[model samples]
Target: MSQPVVVVENLVKVYQKNIRAVDNISFYVYPGEIFGLIGPNGAGKTTTLRIIATVLQPTQGRVLVYGYDVAKDAAKVRRIISYLPEDAGAYKYLTGLEFLELVAKLYTKDPKKIEEFIEIGIKLSGLGDRLNDKVKTYSKGMLRRLLVAKTLMVKPKVAILDEPTSGLDVVNAVHVRESIKRFAKDVGGTVILSSHNMLEVEYLCDRVAIIHKGRILVVGKPRELMERFEASNLEEVFVKLVWGA
Candidate 1:
């Protein structure tokens, strides 16, 4: 088996007042794969992603990205990973093109590479002339597309996305999902994303971890889980596991 690009071992996170946002959960994501954390709100999905992204430190256990400990070697992990939060926002004052160019510059000083990155961002976004419009003018769906493009364009070894397609209409949701698939398939990018949308997780992830009440209840391919639970789909399996239906 190929080595995993990301690994989490018995991870735990506790907030103030001893609120355990994430319990002892463990999972691994292989290269060129899209792995998902599926759960309802406050189920600890975002908390786990944040710990992996180095945005938050785990109270116990560890997350390793490409052999670098997220807490001990945070700088190295940051160099290889890009994190997009669920409520991620763009610079509303800047035009979409300007934002991409700005982010590209942050990644590299070479003008050629900057242009190359921006081109990739534009391609991923599928926002043609609208790129010229200021981000403040974009619809909710359009802004999300731009943000997703920004997250993937730099070509990080690992992409951590929280609710990548949340709150978008059907057309826009499909666009975001396709963009995610294209990045993983074409660039061999490794992605770890959290989503409450079962269908989206079913379509996008190579493997999935069903999280509930801060603990991982199951981790498997969608079909495997469906079969194991004797359910028709991931949604039904999730209900059976979490609600014990």
Candidate 2:
């Protein structure tokens, strides 16, 4: 494989009283690929993502974003990464357009692209009529669509989305998945997503890492993994692999 855009080597993270939330796990994500970190709740998915996003420091081992050490070169890492956490807070008082404009300002002085982004997003998200309204009034699906737009507009080298489609209805979730695929292809960037949705991972990710108890149980293409375990789907494989069923 090509040099990994994201690399983790023996990564470990501990919480209060040194409880190892992430325990000596390692993985690599190549460019232009959709990689999923699949796991149950409290399985360390978010913690691991936070560390890779440079929001949290690893207690042991190392994480690198395109060879920039996350610890020593976080500012550079942040420049090339757009991270959307599971419950990312929004400025509820700002209009959707205003919110995106603020995000654009963080990366560039030109608001022209922000305008373009708003136009494209409002159309794709079917939120044009609501774009002028405060984000506080947006529904869950609407919020999801807006955040997807925000992440795409940044044009980062890697887009890390934690549970990007957590609360959307089926149609909205499908739309979000398509948008994610397009965003990665457009920039030739790596997309790493963490989700418990097996069907979503099977359909969206090029490959997945199954995490349990803060450790990786398996990593492979969804089909390959299912076949290896003599299963019919990712969910079945997950049960067999994690539950010894």
Candidate 3:
């Protein structure tokens, strides 16, 4: 495999009351691969992802992005990666165009690139007349589309998406998943996805690690994990791991 784009070594995080949201967990995501951290809600997936994204400092251990330590080299990591949280809320007051412009300004100062990104985002989102409207008035699906577009605008070396399709209709969910796949393939970037949607994980991830209660229980290709557990789908494998068959 090529150089790992994302690496986690016994990463751990503790909250205000010393609740260990993420225990000692380790993994590596290779270049151009889609890696999924599959687990139930409150399974520490979000906390782990937040630490990797550098939004929150890890209580212990390390997360490195493209050889840059997330803690010590946060600036370099930020430049090379984009992360979208599960509850990624936009400035509601900003129009979709304005939002995109703001995002573009952060990583790309080129007006032309910003304009091009906005054009592509508008077209890709199929938001039509709504692009001029403030995001506060947009529907959930529309908001998701815009957020995804905003993330893609960076064209980073790695993209971390937390439940990217959490609340979309079947059609929109498929659209977002396909868009993520295409973005990774086109840019040859790595994507780390945390999702409870088992089918989505099976379809999108090149390899998956089943996480539960802050620790990984299993890691392998979806099919291999399924076959190992004598299951027919990812949901079944998840149940087996979480409930102990």
What tens digits encode model 1's per-residue C-alpha lDDT throughout 48-148? Answer: 99999999998999899999999999999998988889998899999999999998898889999899989999999999999999999999999999999
Candidate 2 segments whose C-alpha is farther than 4 A from its true place: 111-124
Stretches off by above 4 angstroms in model 1 are none
Tell me how far candidate 3 lies from the true structure as C-alpha RMSD in angstroms.
1.4
Point out the higher-scoring one by lDDT: 1 or 2: 1
Clashes of each: 0, 0, 0
Q: Highest lDDT among the candidates is held by which one? A: 1
- How do these models rank on lDDT, best leading? 1, 2, 3
| TM-score per candidate | 0.98, 0.95, 0.95
lDDT score of residue 235 within candidate 1:
96
Candidate 2 backbone clash number? 0
lDDT of 3 by residue, 1-245 (tens): 67777889999888998898998999989988999999988889999888878899988998999889989999899998889999998999999989888888888778888787777666556678898999999989999988887887677788899999998999889878878988887777789999989999999999999899999888889999999999999999999899982
Report lDDT (Cα) of residue 239, candidate 1.
Answer: 95
Worst 10 residues of 3 by lDDT: 117-126
